[model samples]
Target: MRKPVLTIFYQFNPWSTTIGGIQTLINIFIKYAPPEFAVRLVGTANDKTQPILKWQSAEFAGKEISFLPLFSLKNDNVRSLIPTTVKYTAALLGQCFESDFMHFHRLEPTLAALNWQGEKTLFIHNDIHTQMQTVRDKKAILWRRFPAAYFAVESLLVPQFSQILSCNTDAVKHYKERYKSVSDRVAYIKNSYDNELFYPLNQEEKEVEKRELAQKLGLPDDTRFVLFAGRLHPQKDPTLLVRAIAALNDPCVHLLIAGDGELAAQVRTEIDTSGLTGRVTMLGAVPIAQLAQLHRICNVFVLSSAYEGLPLVVLEALASGTPVVTTECGETPKLLTSNSGIVCRQRTSECIADALRKVLQHPEDYPIESCVETAQPYAARTVVRDIYSEMLNRWEQRVTFAVKV
Candidate 1:
């Protein structure tokens, strides 16, 4: 039998050195794609001059997968937005026509490819409405200016997709409730972590790793580390973690920020203003292996995001047997067990500080076994296999129906 081709579209260089949850999820989909199907990826090229419709291939899980990187003008300013959209959409459509199924990782790219008459899937990484309400980035500028247009995309256009997947269970419920017309298509497919790379380290191993990290970052060997590993963007609210660390005011409690982004400057200013200069270390986007090691050695992992779908960092931390202190967002409240971690009642620095203090003061309360157990279900291979099975089943059913018709 000829294998079905699944083409995934998202804006950004997936092959880049530094990537976030969406890109990670894309890679998982490619890596664990059933042997019965072929996969192709469409993403923006790093080089602006990179030609569109040029085919490339990369090996994943001992199999070759096709890649198509499109080029577009930068949409940093308002003047270039329309042209960038048009160019990207045209380029995407040209490549998408031949694929058996299309999977989109972002709303904008999915919106652009709506004209394509094929089986389409949309993955919701974050709640779009919540993002629009809370985020004030370049993308949000247009969304804010045209609320009705955004609503139309959410209400009318979204249901056009054959399937809708959300990493957050709450988001799946939200989509089902809001878009009753396509409720059946909306499902929860969780984000996963590399369990092989992220697992509990023994006490002696952890101490050794901690000492090495301390030496590299020039921190005291006995320092208690609190880690926040994600983009320093408005949605992430990275400064909130900085403020919480300062508010805790424990001389030995140190924060290690592993990622950098748009609010990097602002976060630095907050750290300086709060007099947390030496206490906070900015590692600036460490690799996954390094991040996992940080997770293993840290006293607690913190996420102060204004909103999230389901953060992979939190799962990675749990898999590394590290307790978490995260604001009540997305699936964190449901995801965290009382014996495993703490979820803040409020999104305030004081609340986060108190939560952190509790976890740090009584690490024994959140057992390493409990934390690792919490992360087991989100293991990469298991979740990706389940997702692939679901996609394949749906595709097979559609094909059977088409033949019957």
Candidate 2:
């Protein structure tokens, strides 16, 4: 029997843009797709010049990588929203006319997927419902909260999906409470990272790499680097690290931030205005290669996000045998067991600063071996394979029952 082809609908392709965690998640699967199945990815074209209906393909890890890019559009405006979404989904449905399963990545794609036919499964990456709700409740800028109105509408149809893979406990809890009728369908599925690139380096290897990284960034040998690599938006609260570091007043401790978002300028201003000038280096939106090295070379990996579905950066940091200080977002608190890391009681900068100081003061308490071991189960290959098997089993069983009828 031929393997079932899984069609995935995602907004961003790793090849097309600088979006990190989601892009990294897709790239890991692309690199390690199982031979038991063929994969198809449909996404919007990042390059405006690329005409619609264009596609590219290659054989990766003994599996076919079929990617089709539809025309991208602005979802902020009300008038063009529905029409553009129709065009996007129509284009997607045109390519994958038949499939065993259809995977929806984000909320926007899920809206479009309502028109596409298949055994649909939702892979929740972020708490879109709450994220959107925050925008709505806070009365954020019109452009920012425009999609909340759409999600609020399409959410009425969420019960149609038979399966939902929640990447964190919070997401699972959210689904259970939000969709009471379909609560039983939601299952926890931990997000994964590329272990091959993010694993811990031995002391000798780390020292060598650290020196090289230091020289590349023109930092002193004695500097203790703290890393935060995520969107500089309000949700991520990148300046929390700046404020924390500023309060610590540890001259030996430096912060390297690598991301860009709505509050990018504010992140810079916070570091500058707080006199964290020489201690902070904001390298807006770094490539994945350098980011992996940053994980291994840095002293601590911290995520100050107010809320996250499952921040892949936390896993990457753990995999690199680097201690972390993060908010109680997603599965972060559960993952920071023992002394492997510190979990902030709250999202306040003071909480982050206190946690940072403790982690730095007693760095020896966090064992490198345990940190790496904690991330072993979440390797991209294993997690992807597990999700693939579960989906295929359900699909194959569904097909068998249909044939019997």
Candidate 3:
């Protein structure tokens, strides 16, 4: 039998300068796609003047990854906003017409692009309802200025996909409840870590990286660090992480934030107002290779996100044998069992501070090995296989339904 041809439509591909959850997903997907699966990536071309469609093959763990580019022309203003949805939607519709199956990552465009006639799956990584609510409450510039046409499109097509896979169970349940027609289509596929790239460093390497990072970030030799490595967005709740560290009142406890976003100015204001000039360091954007080193040097990984589907960084941090202190976002309890790490109440500076304190006060007592093992099941191969198996089932169902029709 001929293997199915799968084309992935993601607006935000991994080639972007800074890393985020979407980038991590693509990296893992490339690593895990089998030889029999003729996988092709269809993303908005990164550079202008590039061909609308381009293809290439690269070896990942000795398996070849066939990549294709689908360019979407955009006005910078509209592109930064949501009309890019229209762009990607058209691009995906074209691909769906061409490929045997189409898999998508982002929610907005995916919702708009899903076709019931095609073998389609939407990969959701966060609660869009919650994210939309936050944006409405904040009246963010992006929300206020963008076209409302996309929202209308999302309302109609979000439930039409052949399958909907959220990164965590909470998101899956929420989407299922909200869209009963597609309840059976909604499922959970947890995020995975790249064990090969993110792992505990040996003593010599750890010592050298720690010393170098300290020197580069202007930290003292004795300073123990708690690191946050994602976009500095309002939803990511970086200010809360800063407030937590300030509440600690521990001069030796340094907070390292390693990403940039629209909320950069707000985070800078908070850092200045809190008088955490030297204590809180913002390494605007670091390369992926350097980020792994930063994870190794840090004693604890921290997140205070208002919401998450399932953060890949948490798993990455754990695989690196770094203890964690995370807000009670999606699947926080699932990630933090009895002996893993501290999970705090949501959006509270005091609660975050308390959790950080517990990890900092007695770091040796926390089972770092258990934290590492907890992430073993969600390794890249396991996650990709889960996605592949689910796609196969969905494809077969599509065929059966078509035969009946």
Candidate 4:
């Protein structure tokens, strides 16, 4: 019998600026999909005008890979709102016409599965329900109608899928509790890092890149830089990080904000007003190639996210032999148990400041090499195999049940 063809749909490309935890999960799916399964990765280009297709026949340690891009029809930040609806609508209609099974990676594609009329697997990365609720609760959405609209749209779509693959244990538990279905329909699979691209930097390479990075960012060789990778959005809470750094009152403790987002202006304003301009360096967006150097140069990495489903930057930082100081959200505490890093009790500026200070003071005690070793199990290859084995076992059980029937 022929192997099953799995169609994996994502809202954005893996290389895009918005790439983070969700993107990492998609990359792992591409890396770890079983060889017996022919995988088709579907995503939209940041723009809304063209379709893209990237094919790879070679396996990542015996797992096959392929990519398909369905660009949005409009060129706007609301690409997911418009292009995703159109592209995924077409994708679903096409899939239904041909009759195929699909596994979608985010909320937008969950809508597509409603019309797919096939076995649908929903991969919930960042919960749209939570996001919409957050904006509404904080009154950040401004227009009361939009939050209601998003909530209604989400309510109309998310529950229609056949199965849901949650990114972390907390998410799985939340879904099961919310939906009142604790069965295999909602399963927890923690994300993994791309060890091929993100790993421990050697001493020589680290020294060279650290000096070069300091030079490029206009930092003194003695400056102690803490890194904040990922988006500069309200959710990421870079402003909170700035407040935390300011509260620390340590002149030597500098912060480097990597990546860009909608709240860039606000973050800059916070840094300026707080008089942390000299202490905080905004590197904007650093290339993936230079990320290791950035991680190496920093004394520690920090993630001040309001929420997360296992932030991939944390894993990347750990893999790069850098201890982390992150907010205690999602799976952070699980990873921090071994003293690889410190998990703040809350996302408050005071808590974050205390955590940062504690880590900075005992940098030597927080073994970077130990952090790297701790993160190895979550490497892309290893996680991929775990996922494949999970899916394969489930499939085998279904086959056995069918045979008995």
Candidate 5:
């Protein structure tokens, strides 16, 4: 029996970077992809200095996977657009023909390979229509101004894909409604977390780890750490978290931000303006191990994002037995329970403040066991296994139909 080659494509390198949830999810998919299939990862190099088209092999989770790095411009300015698109499209057309199936993580890459005649799948990480409307940054808003153009492209491209996967159920509904022609192909697949690395720690163990971490980070032993671990982008609304913390007005509550992005300076300014300098610590892009430890030690995890698909950070926090206080975005409201965390009624800082205060004030209400239990179904092994099985079944059906024709 010959194994089908599944070429997974994304804009950024997953093995070398911790950029976002998409990269994390792709790694999990590759790790748990069934043995009956051969998987190849195709992505752009993060380093601008790296040459365009190159092939390499990387060992991940004890398995050797083929990698193809394509060239991408540093910025998406007018000057770079033509060359970037031409190079990307040419590279995909030249390299992707041999694969049995193509899996794309972003719209741009899928569009570049629009001519690919083989089976194709597109994974929608966010509600594209909502993100275009909600993004507040000047540069992002400028690009999103031409929403009609994007809609036209999506209409032409989406139905051509054999399958459409969205982590958010709301996003799945949106896609089905918008692309009624391919409604049957649209499906909801939940994002997963590494359960092995992010499980509950006992009270005594948590206390010991907290003490060590506080000592290392120069915080008081009794400080209640509220963690926000995502890119400091307009969509994430990181400054909103700062304002919420300041509004809480609790001197004992401290914030530890574990990621950085374009809005880092703006978030810092917000912290300074709100007089939260001493109370907030910017840990700036900690590794996954450190992130899990932070989740276990932190009293609560917070996300004040304007929008999301199904945030992996929230799931990771729950797996680490940490309660969450997040705004109502993506599938969060459905994923959360009363015992797991609080979902803010509004996106306002005051609403987030009140939610945070409640969770911080009554820690006993959200037990470690309850939080961990809430995240059990999203364990990487279970979710990825099911996803691969589904992919294989779809491929089998396509083959049978082709043979009949």
Candidate 6:
């Protein structure tokens, strides 16, 4: 029999700026996906481009992963006027109509799945319920100032989908409580990382990579940097880390900030106001390969995000054998055992400062072996195989029902 066709609905353009955790997840899925299913990744073009129907990626071992352009509709004139997101949503919906199974990876595609009658699965990266609640507190649509309309629309649609692939226990609980009808269908699969690219570097290897990176980044050899890599936005709480660093008052310690967003000005302002100008360097938006190197070299990886589904940077840090100091977000506590890293008791600067100090003081406590072992379960092959297994079983049940009739 022919392999089951699974059309994945998501957006990503390596040629564009959206290469965050979602893109990383897609890369892993492409890499470790089993051969039992024929995969078609139906992603939207960031810019106006013709549709892309490509062959399998040899690097990823993916089968016929195609990029469907959102703007290229059957009606050219009307397609031009279709709003980009709407066009993207339409493209995903179009693919769902023909595929054996549908896998949605973002909120827009999830909303689009409302119209798709198939054995569909949801892959949520953000806490939608928390976001909607935030909108309520701010009394703004965040979409406009907050979106009363988006909340209403998502409220109507999300509960109807049976199978949801949750990244953490908290997400699974949220889905179960909110949608009791589909509670049994919510499955917990932790996020994954590229084991080949990011792994524990030996002491000799670490020293070399650190020195090379420092030279490339124009830093002194003595700098013991704490790395914070994520968008500098309210949700990510980069300011919290900056505050903690300033409070530490250690001359040997320095802060290195990567990635940029709306809170860039605020972060710079915090650095200047705290008199940490010379110590904090904003290395805005390094390449992913460079990011892996940074993770390998840094004394500690800090994630002060207010929330996350499961921050990919955290996984990458653990995989790179770097100890982490972080607020409890997503699967962080689940991922970090006592032997691996430190999880702060509170979100305040003082609490974070104390945690960082403890980690910095005890280099002997967190072995490279423990960190790598913690990350082993989250390897791309292991997690991706489980997702495929769950999806394949569901598809088989659907096939059985079809055959019965």
lDDT of 4: 0.69
TM-score-wise, the better of 1 and 2 is 1
Best by TM-score: 5
RMSD (Cα, Å) for all candidates, in order, is: 3.2, 3.9, 4.0, 4.2, 3.1, 4.8
Computed on alpha carbons, the lDDT of every model, listed in order, comes to 0.79, 0.74, 0.73, 0.69, 0.81, 0.72
Residue-by-residue lDDT tens digits, candidate 1, 181-228: 889989887789877788999877888888887877787888889999
**Every model's TM-score:** 0.90, 0.87, 0.84, 0.81, 0.91, 0.84
| Cα deviation of 303, candidate 1, in Å | 0.8
Judge candidate 5 at residue 222 and give its lDDT. 85
Candidate 2 or 4, higher TM-score?
2
Comparing 4 with 5 on TM-score, the higher-scoring candidate is 5
For model 3, how does the per-residue alpha-carbon lDDT over 195-250 read when each residue is reduced to its tens digit?
A: 78888875466668777777777778778888999887666878888888888889
Report the backbone clash tally of model 5.
0
TM-score of 6: 0.84
Assess candidate 2 and give its TM-score to the true structure: 0.87
Q: Candidate 4 versus the native: TM-score?
A: 0.81
What ranges in model 1 sit over 4 Å off?
Answer: 48-51, 60-62, 72-95, 135-142, 396-405
**Candidate 4 C-alpha lDDT tens digits along 1-405:** 556667777656554545356665666677666667777766655554334544434333356556556544322222232344456656544343212457766565465456556567777665444545554125323323377665566567766767787766777877777666435578876678878777776656666766676677677766677899887656777888999999999987788888776678889999999998888887776666677667766778998876677778888888888888988766767886456888887778999889889888987677767888778877888778876776666666766787899
Give the worst 10-residue stretch by lDDT in candidate 4.
73-82
Best by lDDT: 5
Candidate 3: regions farther than 4 A off: 53-87, 90-97, 111-117, 133-155, 202-208, 389-405
**Per-residue lDDT of model 2, residues 1-405, tens digit only:** 787887777655445436457767877777776677778877666566655566677453455778776766432112232444456656555343446777776544455456556788877777655566564224222324477566476566687687888787777887888788888988888799988788888867877877776777677776778899887656777777788888788888888988876677878888779998888888877778788888997878898876777788889999999988988866778877776798888777788988888887787888788789888888987888887787778878977998999
Among all windows of 10 consecutive residues in model 1, the one with the lowest summed lDDT is: 72-81
Candidate 2 has an lDDT of: 0.74
Of models 2 and 6, which has the larger TM-score? Answer: 2
Can you write out model 6's per-residue Cα lDDT over 322-377, one digit (the tens) per residue? 88888876678767989788888788898889988888788779878888888888
